[model samples]
Structure formats: C-alpha cells, structure tokens
Target: PSEYFKGMLSRVGYAIFFIPFFITYVGHGFFSPGWLLCPGFYLLFLIGLSLPTALLNKKLVGTSLVFTGLLSGVIVFYQVNKLSWLSWHKPQRQILQIIEDVGTSQTKTLQIFDCMAAEKNATSIYRVVGYSSSIQEIFWLNHKVLPEIQILPCSEAGRSVASLTPNIIKLRWSFPEFTVLTH
Candidate 1:
C-alpha cells in the first residue's frame, strides 16, 4: 500500500512538472491547434518505451518505432507540401491580389472594409495583404477618419446600396459571386 501511494505521488509530481514543459515546447510561442496535436507523438514514444523489448524481440520493437517515426515525418511533409497545391483555391488570396492590382493601377492607397462582425478576420487579412485600413462601416470619405476602400459582400452591392448615402463614390468590382466596393 505504501509502495502504491509513493508511486501515485511520484506520478502526480511528474504530471505537474512535465505537462507544462511539454505544452511550452510544443506550443513554442503560440497555442496552435496543430501544436496541441503533437502530444500524440509522446504517446507513441511512451508506448514504444513501455513495450518490454527484453521479453519481446528487441530488434522488432526498435525497427517498428524507427519506421513509424519516419512515416510520420513523411506524412507531415506531404501535408505541408499539399497546401501549396491548394493555395489557388483560396479566394481571399485572389481578392488580395486584385486589391493590390487595382490600387497600383489607380495610384490609391489600398484601404478596405468588410462586414463589421468579421472585423478581426478582416484586420488579419489586411495584415497578410500588406495594407492597412481604418474601420468604419459607413462607406464615406472622411479626411479626419482617413480614406478607405470598402469591401462588401456581393449581396450588399446588388441591392443598389448607393441610395443609402447620396454623396458616396462607390467603385465596385464583382468576381463570380464575390464582390468588393471601394469608396
């Protein structure tokens, strides 16, 4: 009973110490969901270590773990490489490129606004596109608020939205079902 109690205490202590270190190492600087999934690797390592290699064939255990690790690495590499193949399917990248081209052609600073509810994603998207825009849902040019290009859903533009504000100069571009408006 004392031996079991001691084992339990040691396990609790190890858990308290190891979990934080493992989390920090896997997460590095940010708590990525992909990083969180990395603990599965540790599970494999534990299983490999706990398999009684002395009772079972040591050669088999070592070879299987080595092969599993290599296969895991190859799978990760393939998945990462597959993202490039999927890049063209992302419409946000297309919109970003269009904004850049239009801004350069017209010699206007690329400033954009999207749905107010998506403000956080919009800001991150702008950051990724290498442009900055102020937040204002009302598509109006205010010298004090800074001139901005408004990015609206196609549905919003089709409703003859110009009637909402009389003096607004809204230049809109429609691509397939998606559209953006610049004012």
Candidate 2:
C-alpha cells in the first residue's frame, strides 16, 4: 500500500517534468492563451534533464544531459524561426529578408491592424533579427503612446515555421490603450 503512493508520486513527478515540450507543442495548436497552458514550457526543461539512457547515452548521464540540452536548445531556436529545426522554408526566407533589411541596429516600424479584434488599434511591427523586449522598450521611449507589441516570426533569424500559422504572437497591448498600436 505504501509503495502504491510512492508509485503515484513518481508518475506525477514524471508528468510534471515532461510538461514543457508538451505545453509548447500544445500551445502551438491553440488560439487564446491561458495560465493553465503557459507552464508547459518549464516542464520542457525538466524533460530535457530526465531523458532515458538508451535514448541519449547509457554510460554517461551527465554527457547525455548536456548533449540533449544543446540539441533541444538548437531545435527550439530553429522552431522560432520557422517551426522546424532544420528546413529553410519560404516564410522563413521572407521573414529573414525583412529582418535583414531592418538590420540589427535599426528597426523598421510598420503599422499593423490586428486581425482578431472588435477593433484592433493600428500597431507598428518592428522588423528586427529576433524577439527581444529591450528593442520594444526603445521603440516605446522614442515613439508616441500607441498600443505597442513586438512582432517576431520564428523565421526572424532564419528559423522556419513548420506550419502556416494565423496569429503567431499573442497581443501584448489592449486596443483601448492606444489608437495607434505598434505591432
């Protein structure tokens, strides 16, 4: 009877650990974001740590973890670009073109009207290399008080998105905040 409780706990622990990749994968499938679904990413970190020996390496657990983590990191980085860790898809290329034109030092602010809103205020879409909050902050400091949000494609840094997504990013600013929104 005592062993049953221990077994249940072990299963729970394993589930909690694998939650991240599952969440990220699940999150990709949904539209409206919720708190319940957000924590899956943290589970991925645990999953990265807990992979079985035969899958990665049996002899050296440390080496397996390090190697798997590096690989997973690379894969995540690639997924953000497009969705796949490997291929250079068209959307990825298109986004890369936009990023290159904008350059690392410069930001190309393009006004964007929200697709999913009763009334989405116009927001500027800053085309840069990748996603960064610092870049958005600078835009806000220099510019007018419009509802501002960063637009980062998985393809921003040449990582191609696997699917043709509708709205990749969740909106950061509410429509009422600014008549003009930076997308």
Candidate 3:
C-alpha cells in the first residue's frame, strides 16, 4: 500500500499545489453557492493529468514544468488584478447589465430566479449578481424566501410572476432576454 501510494504521488505529486485552491473554492461556494461546475476545479484536474503524462514521457517534464509555471503565474496575475475574461462574455454581460440596473447596497440581499432552475446543474444566479455588484448577500428563489429583487428570463411566466408579485415595482429596462423585479 505504501509503495503504491508513493508511485502514484511520484507521477502526479504536483497536484498537491492545487489542493488549497480547490478547498478555498469549495469553501467560497458554501457561503455563496454559484457555478455548479467550477472551471478552476477542471483546470487543476487537467494540470494533474498532464503532469503525470509529462513525467511518463521523460522528454516533456522540463518543458511542461516551465509552461505550467508560466500559466500559473499568468492566472495569479489576472486574479490579483481582478480581471475577468469569462465575465465579459455576451450572455454574462446581459445578465450583468440587468443586475447593474437593479442596483445594490452594502446591506441589501438580492434574489434571482430564472430558467436556470430547469437545468440539472444550473449556475446560481447569485454568482452572476456577485460579479456585477457589491451586494453583500444574494440567493436563488428556488425554494427560498423571496428577496427584494427578483430576476427572471424574459418569458411569459416571468411577466406573469412580475405582475402578480406584490410590493414589487417592475423596472423598465429593456433587457431583451431578462426581467428585473424589485421593491
């Protein structure tokens, strides 16, 4: 058992460096549930797999190590700078614009609902809100208490929910794909 463990570690030992990030990401999720599938987790997994393959090939280990180091450095720099390449994508930008129009305050909590609930492993709307605002807390309306603000996809159901909801003033933003409801 000890030999087998050692053999396994010898090939993929570099993965140990990613454990802390994975733990931090998981911890963050508990406080702010978001993307069901984290890209960072998969990136680490691929790096681990590549590490072992590079080691087995012998000729690639040094080059792979250098490339990995550069990649990690770039990622660290981007994170430290608070740059988000993925956040600016079209769908994300649309959602973010709606979140921005809803506005936020340090003390308020926001809740969002959408077709995301229909997907098996849906990304939490809170995550999208978090990226665009400084609101302290956000939740999904999926089996949770209704919050002051609700966001839904621009659908008939969304319009009906907005119209039926009390104490909410529907915002007049033309988000061709989403609806914003607020108090």
lDDT of 2 by residue, 85-126 (tens): 233243334433333333233333432222323322122122
Model 3 CA deviation exceeding 4 Å by range? 1-16, 27-88, 99-111, 124-147, 150-177, 180-183
Evaluate residue 156 in candidate 1 and report its C-alpha lDDT on the 0 to 100 scale.
69
Off by over 4 Å in 1: 1-36, 55-89, 104-155, 160-183
Model 3, range 1-183, lDDT digits (tens) per residue?
354346545656656675664576664533221232244444445544544443646756557656766776666656533423244254455554544454233314344444544431223444443332332232222223333554545364455554554434343223123445554
- lDDT per residue (tens digit) for residues 55-96 in model 1: 246666568767877777676667545433234245445554
lDDT of 2 at 74: 60
Clashing pairs in 3: none
TM-score of each: 0.35, 0.26, 0.34
TM-score of 1: 0.35
Models ranked on TM-score: 1, 3, 2
